[model samples]
Target: MSDQSVTDSRLDELAETFEFFDDWEDRYRYIIDLGKELTPLDDAEKVPEYKVEGCVSQVWLLVAEDAERPGALQFRGDSDAHIVKGLVAVLLTLFNGRTPQEILEFDARGALDRLDLAGHLSPSRSNGLFSMVRRIRALAAARGGQSEPTLH
Candidate 1:
């Protein structure tokens, strides 16, 4: 598979793994493993301006949409913590390039339920993840509605 295809496949696999794990420890290990699979962000994309604030670990995100593929955002991210980075990677694979309406409609909490991940996570980590998703959705809305102010 090409790099992007592999990433998409890996995310599908992760959803499967989350479904299979019986315990949080196993899930945690799997999340860390997912972290290991992430492609490191390019050095040029790691500028302080791209940093995602409010995350306990260092997190950076870059968003772009291919002109040929309208409404789909492409995301690249990195973090100092392996597991956190993995989580970001998962989010990128699932939501990148999607329309703002789709992003607004996406039930991240529901997806977590499908993954069986929420009950397994530390509350703080879960909160941070929510924050990340909100930020992405907000960005999508901003770009999608360039002429209007978006409501939170």
Candidate 2:
């Protein structure tokens, strides 16, 4: 795929990084560290509109059209749970700075499977993760001039 999308390239990089870990514990620690690296969100941004619906934790994701990069999206996300915040960081790494079509076409399930996350995550965590994916896609749809997205 010579014309690779940014989302695919970033996901590949993450899978390579995840493979360096010999154990899940180490992977979890790495994820938490990634969360720590996320662009901080203000308390005021933690309002209902940004709140992810399916997560047990208080999860928020904010999406915006990036002024610095035309046709690219920017994101900020946070979660009360450490691991969930890490998941938010993962999502940001995949979707941030991508164009709307890139986000809409991203194979999230495939990416998670490649990272060995599909089976490792608890069902609740999986649902929460997918919820965040849906939120990102929905926002992307709107940004692309589609009507407000309905959860698929």
| All-Cα superposition RMSD per candidate | 5.0, 2.1
Best candidate (score: lDDT): 2
Error of 1 at 131 (Å): 1.6
Q: Model 2, range 48-132, lDDT digits (tens) per residue?
A: 9899999888999888888877998998899998999999999898888887877777777778778887578899998899899
Global lDDT of each model? Answer: 0.71, 0.85
Give model 1 RMSD, 1 decimal: 5.0
lDDT of 1 at 86: 75
Error of 1 at 133 (Å): 0.4
Lowest-scoring 10 consecutive residues by lDDT in candidate 2? 1-10
Candidate 2, residue 37: the lDDT equals 88
Model 1 misses residue 17 by how many Å?
2.4
Q: Specify the highest-TM-score model's number.
A: 2
| Candidate 1 residue runs with Cα over 4 Å from true position | 1-14, 146-152
